[model samples]
Structure formats: C-alpha cells, structure tokens
Target: MITDRLSLGLQLLRIIVAFMVGGYAINECTQGFSSEKWPTVKGKVTSSTIKEVFTRSGTSHHEADIHYQYVVDGKTFKADRIIFGGANFRSPKELIEKFKADKPVEVHYKPGEPSVACLETGVNFTVLIPLVAFGGILAFMAFADMSKSMQPNSSIGPRPASNSSGLAQPKMQQVKGIILFTGLVAAIFGFKYGINAIHFGAIPGNAIAIVVLVGGGFLFVTFISLLPAAAGMLARARRFDLAEKVAKLNTKIASTMSAHSYETAVAYGLQAEIAQEQMKYPQALELSKKALNVLACRPKVDLAVNKFDDSTNRMIKESTIRYEKHYNDTESLCNESYGSILFDMGMYGDALTHAEKAKRLAQDNLRNAAAPDQAGTKRALAGALALRGKIELAIGSPENAKSDLQESIRLRKEIPHQFEEYLAASMADLASAYCVQSEFRMAERTIEEGLKIVEGSNKPSHRLAKAKLRAQLADVKMGMGQLSNAESLLMESLDVREELLPAGHPEIAKTYLSMAKLRDLQGKQRDAIGYRRSAGEMLTNCFGPQYQAV
Candidate 1:
C-alpha cells in the first residue's frame, strides 16, 4: 500500500524532526551548546589549600567582577552559583593531588549577562555534557533515518490486504484510536488537576508545604493511577517477565528531569520507592539513583535548611550516611539533632556514635557560648543524649540503653518548656528493655506511666506508646497461653495500624504474625497459613528477606 510506505516514512521523518527540535530547544535553554560554561572553578595548583569562597564575598581585585583565590588558580574568578564541595583542602599539595593539576579550570560569575564573565573554561563538564549530548543524539538520529531511507525496498515486504478482515479493520482502527485518545486525555487531565490541587492547598515549594503537597499528590495519584498501571503491570507482570520493561521504564525516568534539580531528585526517588513497594525492585533502584543524582545537583542552602534536608533525605531514602557526613560540617546543635534522625533510620552504630559526638560537641559549644545561648545549648545536649540512649537500645545494649534513656528522660523532664517530644523514644526503648528482661508487669507499668506523662504533653500524641503497649501486651498474653486475650489485643493493634498506615506497613506485618499464632491456637489451619504467608510477604517487602526476629 502506498499509504503504508508513506505513513512509515512520515513516522520516521517525524521522529527525526522531533529529536532535532528537542535538541535545539535543550541547547538553547542550556545556553549555546558549544560554549556551555563549566560549573566548577580552580585557582592556583596546590596539593593542600582548602577555603570557602561565597559568591557574595569573594576577595575581588576588580570592583566590577567577583574574584576568588583557590590553590589551583591562586587568583581565579567566579560565575554564578558558586558552592563548596565536601573536600576542604588545607595545602596546595593536597589540592593538586586531589584535583589533577592538568584538569581544565574555569571560574563562574553571577549576574548572567553578555560578556559578564560568568563561567570559566577548563572546569568540570557538569554544565556542558548535556548540551552536547542532546545535540549529538539529534544529529545521530537524523543520519540513521537517511540510512534507512536509502535501504533497498526489496527486503521490506508489504503486507497483503486481508480480504476476510478488511471489513473489520476500520472498526478496529476506530477502537484503538478511541482508547489511545481517552488515555491521552486522562493523563493530561490528571496532570492539570494534580497541579491545581497542590496550588489550592497553597503548598509551599520550599517550605513544609512541600511535604504536604508531595505526600498528598503521591496518595492521590496512587489512588487514581494505581488501578490502571497495576492492572497493566500485573497482566504482564506474570505473563511476560518484567525485567526488560522495568529496565526501559527505569532508563526513561533516569533521563528525565523537572525544572528544579532537588525536586527532580525527590520525584525520582519517590517514584523508585513507589515502584519498589509495588514489587518492582529493579525499577525502584533505578529511579532511586536518578533521584539521588538530582538532589546532588541541587543548590546549597543555609545551615538549618541543609540539616533539615539531611534528616529528610534519610527518611525518604532510608540512609543515615547523608545526615552523618553532612552533620560534621554543620552547627553542633544541628549535628546533635541529626543524631536522633539517624536513630530513627535504624543506623544504630552510626546513631550511637553521632549522638555521643553531638552531645560532646554541644556541651563543648555550650561552654563556649555566651550567657544568652546557654539555654539553647543545654536543650541541644539533652536531645543529643536522649537520642544516644534510644540508639543504645536499638543495638540491644540494654544497660547502656537504660542509662541513656533514663538520663534523657530526666533531662527532658527538666526542660518542660522546651517540649522535646523526640525524647519520647527513650521511654519507648526503656519499656522495650523491660519487656526483654521478662518483667512484664514492670514493662506494662512503665509504659502506662510514660503514657500518662506523654499523653497530652506534646510527646507524639501517645499513639506510639499505645501501639507499643498493645504489641507488648499481645506478646505477653500469647506467652502466658491466653490465646483469646492475645488475639483481641493483636486485633486491636492491627485495626489501629490499618487506620494509620498504608497496606504494606511493617507494623501491619508484625500484627499479622501475632494473629497467625492466635489462628494456629484456634486450629484454623488454613487461616493461619494464609496469615503467615502474608506476614512473610510484608516482612520481605519492608526489610527484605535477611531480617530475623530477635
């Protein structure tokens, strides 16, 4: 069919044209492709000379342009958005070795203007690579199309007209077109509605509003898109191995970026997490790395903002290393605050170490602080020590854990005005320690007492305490062979969790396991087996297969 050949040729031409247009757009947005400025700068070549030069206050020889001195290029210039890398060089020798001497050095300047001297040449290609890649890809696609067009048509067999199906073909085409058009409309509507929803809520792009907006968007989109993607994923998830599809999806996501760097990373990371939760581990990992890279490229902020991000990233990506390493460069109080975040991430060793270090740092900083700052220092120290205690418990070092927890509780109690709800974890750990010691009565009593103190005292709403108490009570009753009592308590906990958590939460799995035991006691063999299987699946999903109960 002449129509078929023409259609194929048109499709190829469209693709080639689109790529060229996209490449041009990307190049223009990124600045002239060949002259894209390097983000990094270098000063005099030195092996050891580390110093921070803010964009605003670099020692400038010329009043008009911003000039800074570095070991690589003793007197270098700066462009816009200068930042400090983790490495701090103290000597020229160190700088030389760390950064190869022969490396091209470029200086960046602010106030993007023609001939404003914004970027220096010979710097890292972070800014240049993309501009070149997009252009090159477009050029390559154009050449490939020309080659295909020149190929002999003898090898391209035209499909013979289907005489029997000819009458049905138009209907099939209509159906396909309708379905595709509907999906396209749905996707566009979803995007517009999603954006509007966030706007109506006045979600802050940089403030706490971001969290609410992102969380709400995730919930909403998941609620809407889940059924379709899931159905599609499931049908093929089993019929066809998802390895190739997942890989392609991952590659697509990794290459895509939003307007903002950090936002892009967060999006990728969250998408990865969503994929992972849906049993798509490969896609999850791929998206997660893309998210991380996006975050890495984000602009640097103030100390408090940076610390907040460190803790937040830990929760989002489930790693404390970012918090710990970054904390060392931050204020002592912020570092101490980050310790508790590390504890929450279950990085017990790092948590303990960082907490103690933070405590010592805070105490030292406090002694050095003026009288006006003493209160803040003491508050920080209490938080640090309290977090240290919780970390101790997580590692199963009860004696030390107890000591730390008790000290933290005492300090927190002493500072009623500060309202340190995070310290409540110390109490939770203490009760857990009591449970481990087989002091059920003592454990129950302690949780009750602590619950009272935390009930309305701004200590996480006492819900956490209630959950822990329920879990412990269930276990205790089960141990005592009070199957019915245990079952009731477990069910209550499960109900509470079901109300509070998502479908596959780890706590839900734990509750299922407890219920499985009760089911076994009642001789509900099928039910027990199903419950165990579910619990196993959830545990595997949350903590992977290596996690064993203590």
Candidate 2:
C-alpha cells in the first residue's frame, strides 16, 4: 500500500517546485515587454569589450561585455542591459564593431528608475526558450512523483499512515493533485507580477521585492520539505515504537533554521509529553531538552515587544506580536513538559525550575495573545502552576503546594476550557496537599468538589481520574477512623479502576494494595494476603518480578 508519508512529501515538494521555479521562469520571460514604455535618453557607450567564455566541455567562445552611461534628471547612471536581461549571446566582435567607446546611442530607461536603462527594448527569446523548457521539465517530474506516491499498494482500505499531529493523511493524498493543478495558474502569474517588481539599476539587484520573494521561495521549498521527511521518518519507525519514531523526527527537526524553530519546539514539546505519558522519563527529558534548545533559537519575545513602541508599521507590529505570542506558548509547553517529566522522575528541585520557567512564559503569553487564544493561554498557566504545585508537595512544601494549586484551580474556574478534567485533577492534588497538612475535613471537601467535575465527564481518562479521587477520599476517611466508610470507598474505587484500567496498569496494582490494607484493618487476614498476592502478580506482569506496587 502507498504510505501517506511518501505521498505528503511528494505533494508538498511538487507544489513548491511547480510554483516557485515554474513561476520564476515564466515571469522572467514575460516581464521584458514592460520596458517598451520606458522614456528614451541620449546616451554614450562608456565601454565595450570582448571576453573569452569557457564551456564545461573544455571549449571556448567570445561574447560582448558592454556598459553605457546616461543622465536622468541631472543624475548620471550606468547600465549594461541591451534588453531587460540582455541575452543576445552572439559574437562580441560584432557588438564591438557596432558600438565602441564614445559612440552615441538612444538609451531607454524607466521613468522613475534612471539606472534601469537598455539600448534595445523588447522580449528576448534567447532567455525565454531555455527557462520555459527547463521549468516545464521540472514541473512534469514533480507531477509524476506525486502520481507515483498516490498509487495504492493493496486493494484494501487506505494504508495506515499518520503524522505525530494525527492529521488525516490518506484523505489529503486523495485530493493533493487537484490542489496543485488549481494552484498552478495563480502561483505562476503571481510570481510573474511579484518578481517583475525587481528593478535592476546601476547598483544591480537592490530591491525589497527581490529579497522578499527569494526568501519566501526558499522557505517554501526547503522548510516545507521537512514535513514529508518527518512523515517518512515516523512511518519507517512504526514497527519499533512511538519512542523510536519521536526520536528520529526530533533529531532532524532540531537542526532546522531559526525561522522554523518555533514549529520545531512545538513538535518536540508534544513528543516530550507523549514520552512522559508512556512513562519513559529519560526519553522525555531528552525530548524536552531538544524542545528547549530549539525554543532558545527562536526570536526573543521581550525584545520584539519592546520594539513595538517605536515602530510605524502597524501591520508588521501586530504580526510581530502574534509571532512573539506563538513563541511564548511553545516555550511554555516545552518547559511544562520538562517539569512534568522531572517530577515523575522524583527530581523535585529540578522540576520546580522548569515549572517556574513555564509559569513565566505562560504569563507572558496571556498578556499578549490575541482574543481567541486567551482561554488556552490561561490553561497553560494553570498547567504550569499545577505541575509546580505537585513538585512542591513532593518535597514537603505543603504551604507552597496549596497556594499554587488553589490559584491553578482559580484560573481553571475563571475560564471555560475543554480541559475541565484537568481542573478536577488539580483539585485532587490540592486535596492531597491538604491531607498532608492533617486537615482531614478540608481534604474531604476538596476531594468531593473534584469528584463532581470528573463525574460529569464520560471520557475514559476522566473516569480514571474519578477513581483516583475516590481513592483519595478513602484515605481521608481512614485517617478520620471511619473504618466502615473507608472500606466502602476503597471497594468502590477498586470497582471503577478494574472496569476502566487495563489489568497490567500500575494504578490497578496500587488499588489492589489499598484493598489489601483495608482488608487487614477489617481483620480479614486471609483476604488481605490474597489481595497482596494479586497486587504483586499485577506489578510483576507489567514491570518484571523485581517491581512492586509502591
């Protein structure tokens, strides 16, 4: 079956090459006619000489190298074009014979552009033929490659292909050819118009239009090429595991240029998060490092915002602000990912450092982001605070943990977000912190509120979070010496966990451990021992014989 990754790569590449090179050639050829309306001036040939030009085949030929000077509005200018591009590659002996030093000529120069002058004004077929021929061949090759990648390898459903972002790959491939064909006319004519704005004068190639178009073209080609490359890397590593695929993707993306750094950082941050979810702390940390490194390569948000006060380009300034916010959001996610990973690894101090970084970045993002991004930005800040609070709780700083988690909960309540389950999780954390302080009533109250949030959501993850909250509530009851109530809560939590989690999940084993403890307190020794054995077996099955539920 044809993989979507290969198809996507070819698709993006075809669009870029078809648009840029084909457009460049078509535009360069067509724009020579614009010089016909240029005003004429009395000019003199300043220099005319023959230069020996060597070919790759070890042969030699001679061509005319000519220059002329003219005056426009009392300013003297020099030029070399006989036509717009001056592509008559005939004998230099003939050109020298026709025009010599101090020879009089009529120079056609653009009215506003004194330097853009030509002795002759008309289309140059010598330049047009080769460009059209070469461009056509490349465009044909691009389409052919696209066609090849879209073919099916099997008669079954579309081949399973997905990117790290989980976009609809097969569907995109089905219509990518149509997209390219429809875009061809627009890209060609737009390139023709955009490129023709370049007026080469005595200075040669000094035009903002040239810089913008060339830079845009280069980015469209090289930077977008990385997407298909990424798809290929992910597809090749499918057999190995997500970690391998993520590693390969990140290694390539991390080496990209500054213009791509924000995207690279965002990709790495997501990879780090996935690694953490898989319980791969070392891989998570490595991916987090890559995210941070790329983020460091991006433009500094503070400096760009500081320049806003003095800038006249309101559109540019707005775009710059948006760019700054994107970086801020990406960097915040990177730091938050690292903080979560380090916290899971029990490196509380190190986790706190990254949590702080994330909090600050999210705060900055909140201040400058566009209206649509406000709620999402607040969620990021809440996430950072929640992570830092968890780390604080782990390190015996209950007061700090309580404060951070409360503010995090407050932020979550302040905005209606899609991550309402996360708000529940933060509440559970706050309850745990309260439990750590021996405030049993406060802990019970917090856990109950968290339960309400989780109970409203039917998502599997939310259900698992509810089970955890249930377990926490049981602990508060056990501390209060409500033995019957505590036992009832444990049994209920175990039911939910068994129904929701896989048999080998660590959470299941931990729930079994709680059941064993509750049984022991109820004076059922044999039942308690059986629960312990079940917990041990679950842990052993998941993480080998040496591992325990704790």
The top-ranked prediction according to TM-score is 2
Cα lDDT tens digits, model 1, 321-365, are: 233322221233334433443443344675577677768866665
Off by over 4 Å in 2: 1-260, 299-311, 367-372, 495-513, 516-520, 523-550
- Against the reference, the lDDT scores of all candidates come to 0.46, 0.67
Q: TM-scores for all candidates? A: 0.37, 0.50
| Candidate 2 minimal-lDDT segment of 10 residues | 1-10
Query: What are the per-residue Cα lDDT tens digits for candidate 2 across 10-63?
Result: 555555654555554554444465566668889999999988889777999877
Model 1, residue 299: C-alpha shift (Å): 16
Mind sharing the TM-score for model 2?
Answer: 0.50
lDDT score at residue 339, model 1, on the 0-100 scale: 46
